[model samples]
Target: MMVRSLIDIFSAKAFEIDPLHFQDDDIHMKQALVLKQVKHVLHKLISEDPLESLYMVDIIQRLGIEHHFEEEIEAALQKQHTYLTDFSSNHKLYEVALPFRLLRQRGHYVRAEVFDCLKCNQREFTEKYGEDVKGLLALYEATQLGVEGEDSLAVAGYLSYKLLHAWLTRHKEHHQAMYVANTLQHPLHHGLSRFNDRSIFLSDFKIKNEWKCLEELAEINSCIVRFMNQNEIIQVYEWWKDLGLAKEGEFGRYEPLKWYMWPMACFTDPSFSNQRIELTKSISLVYIIDDIFDVYSTLDQLTLFTHAIRRWELVGTEQLPDFMRTCATAVYDITEDFASKIHQKHGLNPIHTLKKSWVRLLNAFLEEAHWLNSGELPKAQEYLNNGIVSTGVHVVLIHAFFLLADTVTKETIAILDDIPDIIHSVAKILRLSDDLEGAKSKDQNGLDGSYLDCYMNEHQQVSAEDAQSHAAQLISNEWKRLNLQILTPNPFSSSFLIFASMLQEWYL
Candidate 1:
């Protein structure tokens, strides 16, 4: 039935289709046709030469349409993986680095040793590659996937950064300078590709004519996605209004749109609309609860609320203040709703686990409250350990795991229960990054001592600027571990890992 509709749309006279007067059904049909056309191009590219296939895959991914051709991409990468050893020393830096980054992005292990041939006698990249802007960009992007102890990648990263900055300085007015500038700030490996502006790529005159179909598909798909996301924002806004937590003036800033952007950025596809909506709700509650701990509630009230959450019962929450009770009830109902849905759909009961995650989060919040109430500051590592959970990344991801996981096994559940390395890495990165920003603004001093504060407290000689620089380095190191985690074997599903990584990327 869908195929027939698409065929009809395709067979319709081109002149009769009016872009200015598209009905809802016409818009959907046109989108489906464009998607189909792009898939055809994808297949054609896959069957072409390996380099062209790699380029198309990169473009499709950068355009955020890779989800539509997962199997084909896997096959293409598999075919390309066999030829990894075939790259001679004569191959250009761009040729070697592009495949390396693509393979690592897909969780296929490629050794950093492949770039050893590109190094000169001083064990640094040659200055001649500096003129090859594309190669320099590719090398820089590949270095982003470097794991700890990869000294060669570190050197390559430094060299590429210098060259890319020089190139950008000389060609500040060039069409590609914006691309270089954006890449320098947000490396491809650390970016959420789906959230990128598609119009930039669409407007690029340098795109090859053979890939015009893919570009058109990306533009049309972006329009459809934008419309869908707007509708979702409306629906989510309605839900927030109905929840009424925002009515309480004391609840910190009630920016539902800002709260919604995190999940929307992480899950860009329209199919994840439910996850986006529910996660947005959870995030709203997280902010409100955070405010309660940080701004509104007294120590006595927070202690009562924390106990009430740990109990997970309505009978005992009446002793809490009005806003505290409202927040607690909302948290309970939302988790119960999520658990009920998971049980109905996946036949697994997650109430205990879900509630436990919230309890842990509240405990972390309370711990910070205690620190804030007292004049003493925690040690650096001690603060980071608690700040990890207090950042709320774990709670968000825990809720997301059940909502998004296709199959809930004992093994996966156990991994989630134990807090896998990927989740920890993401949470740590967010905690540190948030601290770094808070340090700059000086806003985190009274609310919760940031990692920077703790580090300074420990090392009295370090300047504030130096502490922030060290914190930034710590975030970079965590990214390396995260890259290794994502690229190596793990119990978590690919979707879950991508969601986790993308959440941290959004924070960055």
Candidate 2:
């Protein structure tokens, strides 16, 4: 069976934006003025009581405007971290959980022991706290940030999930129920802030006089940001159209806007426009190359294509098939172009590193092709290990590091070269998620079998449902590992680390 095109699966109209909104000059001026007012308000709020600061910062982040005040948010969080020493039993679960989540998310260490005083036993929080739906929601959000061995957080997560579900059922019409429902589906920590529905918070804040300015700013900024992003998408879409690969090869998918959404979500700030565009180009190549390997090429043709990519040049392409040559040439040229831009701007040459990452990815794809041809099932662990690299996240991220990092030290390069735990964790999450989705879909038959198949093959008598459940548990374990990586010290910049987490969240 042929794989379905994303264009057939997703409605293009859903991604369309109105040109009239982009043409309005009045809105742009209002946005600037309102942005100034919002920054002033944020600075003042950060200087207020710690609890107020935490609440405001949370609001700012949820509104997707936190990038505008990173320094202020950092200072506020640092101050709040210092204030944690003075935290008392008088604080409600909501107060405690909010700070715990905000601080830990920003990489400020906070012990899970802070919840010990509120717990009635090792296994659960006090039953009385369950009545506080707002507190339960906060605890549920905080629990998402928990690392491995934080048994209390794990228990709190389960209890909060159950209690929140119960509360939502009873108060189905309550305004807060909307939040509970959304949080249950996509926890705040695991969600991409850029894609959050700001209108929900705006509606809630409209009732509060103190939050009027914030509401206004969030509203305007969201509109302006949407306009900016839509324009960028238009530009990328135009580039994709002109590339004519989808037209010429007639094999790969055509979804530049969809591909562009990944980097745009990862790097939300407007200044990263070039990085987003270039990364989208690279991503387009990934899909085209993937199609060549998975859907179109014969074994001999794939082996030759792999060899050409390993050679990393156009001189030897005469021996290759037409579609493979087109794909290979595009890959080589785009990679060279990215290296040139990096050299011009950052005065660094990562051409070799960039090319090597792609080679590794292609080799993994070829390995899978080899397995499918041989009709041999790989061990679950072996499949997962290769699938992590085959996910192509490393290539995307390695390209991102050069484009996004402020400084590229030998240590950081070494960490990246080693395929650090952070990258491995994220890659595994994406691979497993893709496999799970593939397991659910019938159209993915052309690909190598998934982890679910491998797991069941290895462990006989495990039902399909049981294998899926185990895959989900593996995904959850990866999330914990990723959370731990984000919180701990690493050679990566904070921007890169956050991007890694956001990318995984976007995939999930």
Best by lDDT: 1
TM-score of each: 0.91, 0.91
Residue pairs with colliding backbones in model 2 are none
Off by over 4 Å in 1: 1-25, 121-124, 199-205, 443-448
> Residue 317 of model 2: what lDDT?
63
Q: Could you tell me the lDDT of residue 244 within candidate 2?
A: 56
**Runs in model 2 lying further than 4 Å from the true structure:** 1-28, 122-126, 202-207, 242-244, 251-253, 440-448
lDDT of each residue in 105-163, candidate 2, tens digit only: 88877988887666566234535766787788899999988899988788888888988
Error of 2 at 424 (Å): 0.7
Tens digit of lDDT per residue, candidate 1, span 124-151? 4545676788899899999998999898
What overall lDDT goes with each candidate model?
A: 0.79, 0.78
